[model samples]
Target: MSMIGLVDCNSFYVSCERVFQPRLCGVPVGVMSNNDGCVIALSNELKALGIKMGTPAFTLQPLVRSGQIHLLSSNYELYGDMSQRVQAVLEEFSPTVEPYSIDEMFVRFDGFAHAPLLEHARQLHHKVRRFTGIPVCVGVAPTRTLAKLANRAAKKIPAYQGVCILHAGSAETRNLLQKTELGDVWGVGRRLVERLALMGIKSAWDLAQANPKEIRRRFSVTLERTAQELRGVPCIEMIDLDEARQRIMTSRSFGKLTDDLDEIREATRQYGQRSAEKLRRQNGLAKAVLVFLKTNPHRQDLSQYSPSLVLELPRPTADSREILHAAGLALERIYRKGYLYQKGGVMLLDLIGADRQQLSLLDTPQSDAERQRSQKLMDVMDTLNRRMGRDTVKLGMPTPGAAWHLRCAHRSDRSTTRWDELPKVRAL
Candidate 1:
């Protein structure tokens, strides 16, 4: 019988960091979020230090000063490259590989006997680690949901040795489900877990045993599908991972709260450029741009003003110039002078396929040549940015000491991607 296998990287970001700086492997290492505001990824050693995900970096200053914990700014470029390398290795193992997330992939295992399937999973796990220097756990089961559960088991159970296979009616599968909490299940959230607890479904096994009809009656079809999935039925379909998003948003918190409109405008313009890049990457166009600003909500003593405005484009376009113009107009309308802004963002709304653009007779006709020129310009800009680093060719010069600049003091080198930053071997 065909089975699904989930290959999940263990402590993906931390592992990526360790691949370059092996010293970070045994240390309590953490990858901070944008602006180094909070911890987003942690190594197993860091988790043992009693620091949870999303713990503010400021609170961990004592640990850092004491040399008990190490925090590094998120190196997204490095992580993205590492993820691609792992995916390339995974493609060698299975023909049909579906990336569930950056750190997880679901691959189909067809026409393999039980023993061979398990052996193949073990080999795939070893090969990924050997080729990419990133450790991964493989979980095989009849359904994706079960495969997810099996993957969790592979991570948690020492006996599994990083590879687990679970058949639907197997005693091992039932024991694993019973041991798993409802909240730990793939589709079950905190709210759903609370609701399930009240319904006497405190574990994955309980949910698996619940009546599917009753689950639908009390909750949504989604929950019912989850219940069915828990019972080894595959209700979820793996859609195209490369599908265009309905909307694109790019935003970041300022390094420091600022009331300067120019600083905010610079940040907004950059965000608009990023949103337009994302829109074009998916071969889509936006009809409008939304600009939003927020004051620091944590400071209740200070007056707060959050404002947002949306400006529609003359016509749907992915041109950064048009998007940035709309974003500027929207920002001017929404920006408050007296309030210190903590964050600002641009959202590309009402996205449509670039090929499906509707022509408007009322608007001045943009000649085909003009449209081609615009596209070619955008293509060139994107290519240069991707080949080089971001902001290598920017629309406008960013002001020095811009408040919107990210605070990443502990960032590591982009050793893999940048030639100048590659690791050097010193003769001792």
Candidate 2:
């Protein structure tokens, strides 16, 4: 009954990098993953250079040395903050908003007229660009599937100016669907594409015209729903509740290998802290915690070794203290006397909301006051660190000089936020 709009940012990671450093404008820059392993984000210029995604940095050494491709380590904090800003801007448009991913969102607009939809979309685009400097493409349609298709078209079509609307039962919309490729449609994976090709359903319009009953019998309920949604039948409803995460894992490769138990414990503590933060943000609690340490899996000449231990909590909690305690105990049990460990991580499982957790009568239960106190403390810590920059007040467990710091050779100074690292610009 309502129109769905899918708003997606273009080159999200690259755009985040450009936000802080305006000098990088029009440059072929890329953000690399941990260990400077590979290019995870590429600017439009770099994409034109024929550098494909997942290409290892070692292979791109020539381009780097030639000054053709600028590279920097991943700045997740900046990207995350920018994502929050974008979502906040989106919330101003619609009452119901679903943050689909780091760079995508879905909004439901019920009362907006067809003529004004373009104006509303244009205003949203201008506001986002003016405020955050991130360009976005918007797609509007009667259903989510068509919305995604319209989004792709919005990005591809120059006349739309980064906004496309596919109205239900419109001749123009039907013609666009007929011309659209099936692979571009949401929920149509490679296997489904092959099967659909066999059935002569090459385009979105063809799939929409196919008998829903036959499609359901041959493929799956998901494909049938996709077909139905394509034909203007709203089989998929907008999800208001946030999707629960199936598993929460925190792991990182070390800058250098070590066999020190204290280093391992420190790494485990940081991982647990990160996992706990994620759990709390998702409104979930973990009942099972796993700690694992491993050596480089690729090194064949050395004796390969890895060990892990799982601990079941007395009760599920999103508290960092509880998760850190469980993780510490697991690390103590799993860490061997002599094993070269390169990385360690914490995994939280069996997640549920704290209010829904079943409590034990015999075990010590956290009172409402204690729960509120813990939440307040965590919230304060999160706010302070986010406002003042990360690691402003880190736990003592994160030992210094464990050799797990990212290889950020070209790190930008926190000139605007940090008191000590102010930037120096010389005047001529």
lDDT per residue, candidate 1, 300-323, as tens digits?
A: 988999998888898899999988
lDDT of 2 by residue, 233-349 (tens): 778876655777878999999878788888778888888888887888887889899998889888776667898888998677888888899998998888887668788899999
**Please, what is the whole-model Cα lDDT of each candidate in the order they appear?**
0.91, 0.84
Worst 10 residues of 2 by lDDT: 410-419
Q: List the residue pairs that clash in candidate 2.
A: none
Off by over 4 Å in 2: 238-247, 282-285, 314-316, 356-383, 397-401, 411-428
* Model 1 residue 232 lDDT score: 83
Angstrom error of the Cα, residue 31, model 1: value is 1.9
lDDT at residue 47 of model 2 (Cα atoms):
89
